[model samples]
Target chain A: MIVVGLLALILAFDVAHAGEIVALPNEEPSLVLQEPNECLQGNSYCAVRTSERRKFKWIEKSATLTMDWQTLLLRLEPGVFRLISGNLWVSPQKGQSEILTVETEAAQFSSRYEFWIRREESQILILSVRGPVEIRLRGDSQVYVLESGFQNWISRVDRRGRAQMGIPRAIDIESHIEVWARLFPGSRTEFRAALEEWRPIWLNAVGLSSEIHQELVHHRELAMAREHRSKKAQAEARASENQRLRELFRQKVLLE
Target chain B: MTRFVLFILCLTLALIEVRSYFHNYFSQSDRLRGEVGKLKERLARETLRRDLMAHQLDDFRQVVATLLPEALKPQRSNRADDYPLRNLATIVFEQKSLNLGLERAGVLFSKAKTHFQQGEYERSNRIFSSLIQNYPDTVHLAESYFLLAEGQFQAGDFEGSVRNLDAMITLFPESSLTGYGMLRLGKIFESQDRFEDAEVVYRTISKMFKDESMLVQEAQSRLKAVEL
Candidate 1:
């Protein structure tokens, strides 16, 4: 009985640790903060500052987003993923798109299916990965449509200053994709798996190419299995935690 | 004298072994106790961290919910702190989505029924599973699940049949076909020789659905059979 209890307690601890918030490492002052709206608390903006190495798992309703990126100040507005600056992966959890508008520093990307976006200091690069992406630059009135494997660049300011009007057509994204693949291997796997699943789907109304798709699927499957196992763990942790809090409150009540 | 010395030595050795065994046991117990204490501490820290994250997530979701178009916003409970009125836009979209789902489910249900009639139980089950998973809110939900279970029972999938029947009954308790579903479930239990279970189901049907004379009569007969 003691052994069983010890094992359960250990498992509970593991569960608690999994869900526990990791203090932002002192690598740099991290800022993942939220200020609630006065009208209705927490009915507004969400700020996240993630280091390059760590992935932040966020649950929005039933959908889950694991954000892994570099030098990003991302704001998740409703039906909109607003990137203030830096790179962001805009792929939905599954190949399924909630059709969220991907907005960056100088351009807005919208797609029927999926699109990926990135922003440098002054220029925003939009990658149309799978379906047709409609890109609207900050100042441009006309919407530029880009197909898969193509990218468009828009600058906030040119040498002369002011939002630079994008006169050039979108170019091929092969070189850019290669650079990104090397930079963000994990995200690359995700994009590839999604690409593989959807590519076949795209070709034959079938969908994924990239051999990397299998790896990504495997990774996701493992995570899912772990999550499934840990769901009970989480429940146990919550129960115990709530019990402890309840006891504390009761003690205070008794004192009064 | 030699035999006495040997017995004495044997007793001392046995005593020493027992002493060591207990020493090890107590040490193990102490270690485990220490581990449990550590585990509790870790759990406390973990819960606190998780709580912080949960708060942030809730805050973020709230903002997102506010920004969502009225049509897309989730249904709200009629609570004091919540807006009770359903948005007009939601009505339109909900109708559209629900209509689409109902249409799709209707098509699948029809297909499954045809398969069931044809004795193609496997094919029917495939369609039923798809329907149950995707179109749970289908208009013929109770019938769909019940028929699925009936088909499984015919196909010798007794466990599957029981599960589906249970789900159907539980999910659609107030459904018009619930009485029939209970009758079928009771019959299944009786066939499986689970007399007690069958009797319980029949009794429940007889008492719970008194308005349905035919159903009550059938359940009472089944209950008598199980009792016998």
Candidate 2:
């Protein structure tokens, strides 16, 4: 009886220990940063900054943009900024033909956000701060900017502003009665920064004078004035033509 | 010698019974313990997995904070390379499992867009026509039909534009671009000096896009033009 009791005890101990010895296969989780969603925020397209060697990925369901690293730049066209989250400031950069969309996602405390990045070439820059940024590339190699911060998102600038770039026609100051300067808010920082950076860079790289700066400003003003006058004249002409038609109709009815 | 033999037999019987009892008892306990250990390990692994996921989220947040500002800065211009449209289409198709219905419609629409951009009206028309014929149920069919109508209008094919516009309006009544389609139809009527028909479309858009400045302005302009 004692022998049997001792054996039973040993067997029970063995059973308990055996349960503790069994184990399962281990699985490690992934550590890669991937795009959060689809439907990228901002404009439909932005300039391709190929020199930056940036890769942008888009998630189709949620609009967001994810950047691989810093030195990647994207911009939005004018009148294309839709408020997604946080505070955004927009301004027209001097001597450029595009709008700048700047966003600060620092203040509002929220992890969920949407971003869209369309890769194209133009001056417009769209910036979305503090949101998941989606980057969509349709074809070809695309270049982008990855700003360093906790806030993420893509700001797009459409390519429609290409037509408004530098004038293709030769200008004759004599034929041009007035010149107006039209400043597009494409890159609020870059275009303005470029101008600020240009003088120093130009003097160092090529060389420039105060006279040249004045001349540049003068030409810009002339272009803006000319565009304004042309638009006004066209509107007036349309109105006048309408009035003429009205008078002619009145006269014909009376004569009849 | 007899006592020795009896003792041996009893010892053997005891050994067998003890072994059997131990096996039966411990076998069940061993299985139960194994299950318990498995549960414990699973709990530990899940905790680790959750922590890893949280860490990944934190890393993504850090990356976003660093990358967005850089994107807004002016970037250096890239060299122009010929974009392989065909290769891109293939890649997109492969990724989406080559949903043939969607792919063919996409091809037709792409062809139409390319032609339209290049100002090849007749070719665009042909492509859009084929799309409309093959995949009338395609989501892009509405857009294709709209493009066909626009192409016709630009090519001065007013009757053709009207026909396609009518089809777009009737077939895809729920399309978001249908408003623009309606606007185009109004413009077509205006061009033909059919003031009454133009007025109907303008008024409809005015009701649909209420408080939308651009559409409202367009409707107002068309209304004024028709009223005069």
Candidate 3:
């Protein structure tokens, strides 16, 4: 009986020490577990209400959280989250992680966008940031991917029942990072660090720095100005003849 | 011997238990240390990235400062003041009476046309110029302007011709002469090797005055020529 009791104690100790003890990196909790409820049988999901005014971040393992209206920064382990209505910014991390699926509504349009990042060949990270966000239009069975970037209109079903996507334009990544930084007051440093790393990459992809883009834009403006000047010169010469014709019509045609 | 074997087995089990306890504790500590090392490396990378960005920003600023001033250099004015006949028209307009009758304007326009036909372009130009200034309210104003521009073209004063032709179209947009004036402008542009301008004028005439079959044909031909 004593031997069995000692074995029970050892078994309890082993169970306690089996899993890796992952302490919260921050002294302050990364996420607030508001209105925590007991998980259902055979499921490890947390049920919590979200609001637009509230900010949330993921700092640990995979778990389901429902967001009604909130901004979430996924700077932790890759996990799936059901965002009923809100924006989420996922930062790229080192090493392979699970495929993150975010069911969220687009900011500008009232359409569902399923954003997912999956590993390709265990190395290449194929991030479908904007495009490949599976969108199924109302009354259509065919699903279409949102063309990359923030779009003005949602993909809609045509008369033939095929999904039609609008032209995709490049999104302003820096502005997005800035918005993310503003939302997370506590993780401002980390967000800014991510921004610092990603900004140059984005800029290089687009061509040059913002300053250089501005210069190129200015050159375009100058070309437009030159065209305007040419047109103006042509118009000025025509003004005198117009004045003459108007006066002629008044004095000769009208008066007579 | 069996008691000794049992004691040896117990001692081995106890030793294993002690070793496992220390191993678990040290492994946890090691894992934490690994995490800390990773964080430090990330921090260092972040610092280096920031420094690189700062350098790039500086380079961009330098490039902008160097190129912006030259790019934004003030374009020279192409006003009437740059022309020799700048004040001549103004002087004539100020000196002439504003109440000339339509008959008198008609006579003046005919005289200008006569001089232009006789190849006395300078004399025709002067008459046409005075007719415009004095009879700014005449019905023959568009005709007078067209004749003056023709005289200018004959005299190799292409700029002056362009000015007058443009004025004719602007002033009398509804007049049949405007279509002809646009065609002439296109020809002038073609002669000057300004094919784009010629093409634009031709396209404008062709598209805007589709009812004028002759003008459309002429513009289409010119457009094709310029495209070539």
Candidate 4:
């Protein structure tokens, strides 16, 4: 009995120390891994690291990483990343999470979400690839949970120099899936697998799909209406400008 | 004797009429020949002029090929007096050395752009910096500065990028890339949480580039975001 207990203790200790090493699903050409120390020294092209504190800055291109049990603090440039697992804290600038705070949880949790974070020119975009994600503006009490096929654009700066949380906007299923395929590589089968494995389950999540679909349709319609209005206004302004210019030219001709 | 005399007179009249007709026809033919000769001369002159223009265009294309070889490829219109050729002529006529300098700069810029596309930011930054330092008077000065700023921004050198962008704006206000530079500056400011500065830059872009519809729209969208 004593021997069995000792063996069990050793096994538990080993399990505790052993970190998860998730497979990096990358094709041969795109998989460039920097040396461990090089990554720590602030090389942007370095692979994602967790043993030491590192800042991963992506510029122009997109990268995807599969994490184990490690937690990473990502300092992003204008780029995109598709995180497979583990936890991530993303901020545009170093030590400035106040603008945007995005935290991802593992799939085991009831509210776990798998998502893609894109740092665009003016905003930080979060797209839920598989599950829902919890997003909050720094210093704000409100936590916005975004479901799959939904996106949010967090503005880096508002009029008051503070970051603002955007409303949850629904993205089309095809676009969401396209983003997944582009970032994660491989065929549709892999994407389906990832989605199936990480799909979130909220309490009383029934009939949520139709509601989300309706919201998406409504958002699309609103966007279309705004675009139409903008085009009409622009056309009217152009016409008025042309009329003014023509009048000025006519007056000059009359004076001549 | 009377009949013979009348026939002889008639024959003489007919011969005279035929002679006048022949004379008029020969004179008309001579004028037509003269016209044909003049036309042939004019055609030769035009063909020679076209050949000279084609040769000059080929030389200008060779210079452009040093920078971007793809630009020299045949395209629609194929006008000999295209903008690049015109610019080349002006530069070459002003100073032959300047044209040579532009060619060198183009080569360097192409290499730097390739590096940038390949994700080699450090090398790209270095080459772009060298091009700016060495070829300040090159036609690509404004674009090179912008690209250098982009490389610096990607390398996490925000301050350097801002300085380069400011320099580009100040030095090349008339450049086509000025609007894009202003837009990028606003984006950087937004990234740094400088809302007022970002708004100012976006507003400036909107005001300055009223004719650039796409750029104006982008600026307007960014302005709305800043307000929100």
DockQ in order: 0.00, 0.02, 0.01, 0.01
Please give, for residues B66-109, the per-residue lDDT of candidate 1 as tens digits.
33454244565655545433443444357576787788898888
* Cα TM-score of candidate 3: 0.27
Give the distance in Å from residue B6's predicted Cα in candidate 1 to where it truly belongs. 30
Model 2 agreement with the true structure over B57-120: per-residue lDDT tens digits: 6435544434433333335233244234333334433535447677778777777878876879
- Which structure is stronger by lDDT: 2 or 4? 4
Model 3 Cα displacement at A132 (Å)?
99
lDDT per residue as tens, model 3, A119-180:
11211111233323454443345555443333223432222223344433344565444454
**CAPRI quality band, candidate 4:** incorrect
- lDDT, candidate 1, A1-256, per-residue tens: 5445545665575466544443322324232323221211242455554444654444443233335554333345655556554455555456565666766545577765545566665567766656677876554567877666555577653222223534323333455455445444366669687446644433432122333356678899999999988998978875674455334322322232
Q: Which stretches of candidate 3 lie over 4 Å from their true place?
A: A1-256, B1-100
- Candidate 2's error at B21, in angstroms? 70
At residue B149, give the lDDT of candidate 3: 78
Per-model tally of clashing residue pairs = 13, 63, 9, 0
Per-residue lDDT of candidate 4, residues B104-212 (tens digit): 8989988987887676889999999999999987756776787788778778898998999999889987654667767778888999999999999989888888886
Please give the lDDT score at residue A192 for candidate 4. Answer: 81
Best-performing candidate as measured by lDDT: 1
**Candidate maximizing DockQ:** 2
